[model samples]
Target: MTLLLAGVTLVSAFGSSFQYGYNVSVINSPAVFMQEFYNETYFDRNGIPMESSFQKLLWSLTVSMFPLGGFFGSLMVGPLVNKCGRKGTLLINNIFSIVPAILMGTSKVAKTFEVIILSRIIVGICAGLSSNVVPMYLGEMSPKNLRGAVGVVPQLFITIGILIAQILGLSNILGNLEGWPVLLGLTGIPAVVELLLLPFFPESPRYLLIQKGNEEQARQALKRLRGWDDVDDEIKEMCREDQSEKLDGRLSVFNLCTFQALRWQLISIIVMMMGQQLSGVNAIFYYTDEIFKSAGVNENNVQYVTVGIGAVNVFMTCVAVFIIESLGRRLLLLAGFGICCVSCAVLTMALNLQATVSWMQYLSIACVIAYIIGHAIGASPIPFVMITEMFLQSSRPAAFMVGGSVHWLSNFTVGLVFLYMVEGLGAYCFLVFCAICLVTFIYIFIIVPETKGKTFMEINQSMAKRNKVEIQMDKEKLNDFQTAAETPKKKEEAHSTSVL
Candidate 1:
């Protein structure tokens, strides 16, 4: 890949996708401080301390609001990318990040926990858009050969962001009462860097050519991205897909829901997104300290162990970035969920027996790390890449909206209910996640195809068999038309040869 391509990926991932991971884990370390702040604020306002149950309810809303905002942001994906273009949408999304960062930074001084909660929602919107748009932008800008690796960059950065947050949230750093607001506010810095650097990069060539019908502009962008002028084959692929989708124009979310041809593609994305979230990965991130504590780790040492878990997550996702192209999407997903399923069962056993068996606590910790490895390799990144691969340009944005909505909604459900699940089910909670992993593994093994080196059209063709549709007949018809157009020329050449 060209330096320019690498630069774009790094910048975009740092500014956009990083926030998703950072925010997910940042709250975990500062949970006690923030809840105390909330109670103190309430006491000052009402001349009495808040009740414990109400404080827990308020905290749940504070955490859950992020994903709730994410759902709203997902709804906006169809319209924003269709109108502003992917690069532009990403640029505009910085507003959501920067504004909230300021509010959150001053939330402590203002003595209003409400500002912090509101800021989470706004930042969540930023995460929502970035989580969808970054992959779409990267998928469109990258050459076909590099698409898988480049698409994984966002997930890699997300892991990095989580690690950074975990490190900063250490007691000596920002996890304490005085430093928590600054930790929350630091999410804006990447957004500022992106807004300054991203405009210099080109828009997605596919978006330019297919959506706007600007052939020369698309050619220029493609040449810049590819670092060569020979982008004709790529352009032709875009043109063919564009022509095929011309009648549909840009599909709206409503159209995606009702369209018969994309039924399986839609179902596939929804299932992947739901599985990605509901499989209990985010629950781990959100409640790592508690999980480790429950597993019998010393209270003082839990924060360090949590940071170690974040490091494992980053390392494994980095490993995935290198291996994704080689192993392909399907196999990695199967392996990831399979590992997670077994780890969940083992973790349950370990957590249950930790009091009875002294070494079982160590086993529980090992199981959690193994689960991170399983999730980081495939479950985290592949679904985002598949969303970009699974749909044609006209329907791609709408498909993202649908998939993203399912992703965030499932995330919201998990974040909201997981505390209660921990209370009610105890060691059995992970078994629920294990079942989700098992079902997801079976579904992927049966239904998902290898999308490692396929074009959007090629991927669609592969799905047609499972969808029970004749989508490839359009390509066959196009081929037949080209053959017919060439027949008369052949006849003329033959006659000249005979006359001579």
Candidate 2:
């Protein structure tokens, strides 16, 4: 990769995806302190101590609002990227981060827990935008040969962010009453760094060429990104895509869902994204301390153990980054979900028998770590990369909006429901995750194709069978459809009739 390309990937992922992981885990460390602050604030306000149930409700909102805000942010992707361009949208998104940092940093002094809750929503919006846009931006800027590796970088940074949060959350660090605000506000630093450094990098060449029709500018950007003089071949490849999609314009989410040609591509992303969240990885991340306590670890040592799992998560994700290109996306996914399925089943058994079998507690810890390994390898990173690969330029943004929505919605569902499942099913709650992982594994093994070393068009063509549509592989036959579609003078009418 060119220095410019590498720089872009690192900065973008750190600013955006990193924050997603940070906020997800940061809440865990400060929970007791924040809840104390909330109850104290309420007592001062009402001249009496707050009720436990209401305080619990407030805490639940604080944790859940991030994903809720993420859903709203996903809705904004289609319009923002279309109007601002990928780089421009990311630049503007820093506002979400900086604003929340200020709100959260000052919230303690203000003696209002509501500010922190609101800040979570705002930061969640930033996370949502970053999670969708960074991957889309990285996927577009990367060459096909390096795409899988480049795509995995965002996920790697996410794991790093999670680990950093875990470490800083230690009592010796920022996980205390005085330090919590600073811990919460630290998310803004990456955004500021990205804002300063990212402007120096070039925008996506495909965005410049395909979306804006700026051929010369696209050539310059591609040359800068590729660190080479010869870009005509890549430019021509983009031109063909632009021509193919000229009649389609940019697809709205409605068109994306309705279009028969992209059916499986849409379904694949939805299923993958849903599976990513619903596979219970976040449940493990969210409840790691509790799980360790149940497994007979001392209360004092559970935080250390949580940090260890976070470290293991970072290590496994790094392994995924190095190996993704060599191993291909499909095999990694199969292996990841397969590992998770077995791990979840084993964890359930261990949890059930831990009181009787002394060693079962150790086995439960192993299962949790193994499940993290399974998730990091394939399930976490591949869905975002696949969204970029599955659709052409015209539909990519809408696809992200849809995929990101399902991702966040499923995330919110897990955060909302997993606690209930624990209440109702006890150890058997993990069996639900096992079932999810198994079904997702079967679906991927049977349906999803390996996208290594292929162009966007090639990937789409390969999906035709599962989508149950005939792809016109010949250039002339494709042009004939474009011609018939463009025959009418009204462009909107032409798109409506032709793309259908």
Q: What's the CA error at residue 296 for candidate 2, in Å?
A: 4.2
RMSD of each candidate relative to the true structure = 5.5, 5.1
TM-score of 2: 0.94
Q: Model 2: clashing residue pairs?
A: none
**Candidate 1 lDDT (Cα, whole model)?**
0.86
Which lDDT tens digits does candidate 1 get at residues 1-500? 99889999999999999998888878877899999999999999999999999998889888888999899899899899989999999999999999999999999999999988888899999989999999999998887678888999999999999899989998899999899999999999999999999999999988887887666688789888889877767866776677577566678889889887788889888888888899899766655666678676799998788778888888899998889889898999999999989998998888788789988877877888888999999899999999998898999999899999999999888877897998999879999999999999999988888888888889888887777776633565445334432453463344433210
lDDT of 2 by residue, 1-500 (tens): 99989989999999888988998888788889989999999988999999899988999899999999999999999899999999999999999999999889888998888989999999999988989999999999899999999999999999999899999999889999899989998989998999899999888889997888665678789899999977766766676677667666789999999999898888889989988999999877766776789777899998898888988888998998889889999999999999999999998999889889989888988889899999999999889999999999999999999999999999999989998999999889989999999999999988899999998878987888778876544476446444543342453455444422
What does candidate 1 score on TM? 0.93
Locate the minimum summed-lDDT window of 10 residues in model 2. Answer: 484-493
Cα error, residue 205 of model 2, in Å, equals 0.6
Q: Residue 482 of model 1: what lDDT? A: 40
- All candidates' lDDT scores? 0.86, 0.88
lDDT for position 458 in model 2? 81
How much is the lDDT of residue 213 in candidate 2? Answer: 62
- Candidate 1, residue 394: how far the Cα is off, in Å: 0.6
